[model samples]
Target: MGIFQRLMKNKELIPLAIIMTTAVAGASSFALYAFQKTDVVIDRKRNPEPWEMVDPTQPQKLITINQQWKPVEELQKVRRATR
Candidate 1:
């Protein structure tokens, strides 16, 4: 029998085609998912969400005893001592 006839009548080709199609579909799906980034940041400052956590970078306003306005914009400083 010719090669084409043999392949056409072969029972194994059906399973092989199914396997190849499944592999291609899975790879395409994975590639699509990999390109999508789910990180979305939403600022709630204008809405003033009561349950939302506050960012420490906002300036803390302080008042001195001498009636002076002191804005203490303190960012937690990490100091490493040299050996």
Candidate 2:
């Protein structure tokens, strides 16, 4: 008999055979993908430009406040009073 006729003859083995086949296919595909080199180019050891380097001793001024803003103590007092 042919392979198909032999497979159908063993009813209990059909599910097991299908499961094994699927597992093998999935594993092979995953292995192929994992072993292949990635398309993305990554530069792990890139050097910063001379201008980009900053002195640790000198602090960088990100923002300058022209006027002194009032504290949130007033809002906190109002919330506490409501509670």
Candidate 3:
């Protein structure tokens, strides 16, 4: 007969059909959520900060610190001499 009638004849298949239906629905929902793209918009004009007002096209000067480098052999010699 119909599918519903077949399922009604076999009562044990009800739980199996419910579990399969739930699994299929869960998988479809997860696939839709995973592949959806979300757009983010930022408004900088409402209340702008000092850093946000700076021109992005202009080059900014960076502060540099002077540091001396020593070779690994020299560092090992210094450590051994100290001991």
Candidate 4:
């Protein structure tokens, strides 16, 4: 006569009902997760840093080194001599 009695009488409908319930719960949880906004702020466009404004069209300039390269032994000796 009641909902439970009806469900017990129709056993095949139980699996269908369970599947529908699970699908609805999953869909609502996913909707909430996808739509919610976070507290984090992103302001890269309003206040741009010096490094962020590089011209991509121009060729990159190679840095010229004034100091000559020393031998590995000398560099190791200097490092070991230092505190």
Q: Which model scores highest in lDDT?
A: 3
Measured with C-alpha atoms, the lDDT of residue 69 in candidate 4 is 45
The parts of candidate 1 lying over 4 Å away from their true place are: 1-8, 38-83
Per-residue accuracy of model 4 over 1-83 as CA lDDT, tens digit each? 98779899999889988999999999999677644423222455664553334443432344534544444787678868984
Cα-based lDDT for every prediction: 0.53, 0.62, 0.64, 0.63
Per residue, candidate 3 scores C-alpha lDDT tens digits across 1-83 of: 98789899999999999999999999999677654422111444664544535443443434434544444788679868988
lDDT of 1 by residue, 14-51 (tens): 77777988999999997776544222224446545432
- Of 1 and 2, which scores higher on lDDT? 2
Tens-digit per-residue lDDT, 11-60, candidate 2: 88788889999999999997786544232223335633332343433433
Q: lDDT score of model 1?
A: 0.53
Deviating ranges (above 4 Å) for candidate 2: 38-83
Which candidate model has the greater TM-score, 1 or 2?
2
Number of the candidate with higher TM-score, 3 or 4: 3
Model 1 misses residue 35 by how many Å?
0.6
How big is the RMSD of model 3? 20.1
| Candidate 2: worst-modelled 10 consecutive residues by lDDT | 35-44
Candidate 4 local distance difference test against the native = 0.63
Collision count for each candidate, in order? 0, 0, 0, 0
- Which prediction has the highest TM-score against the true structure? 3
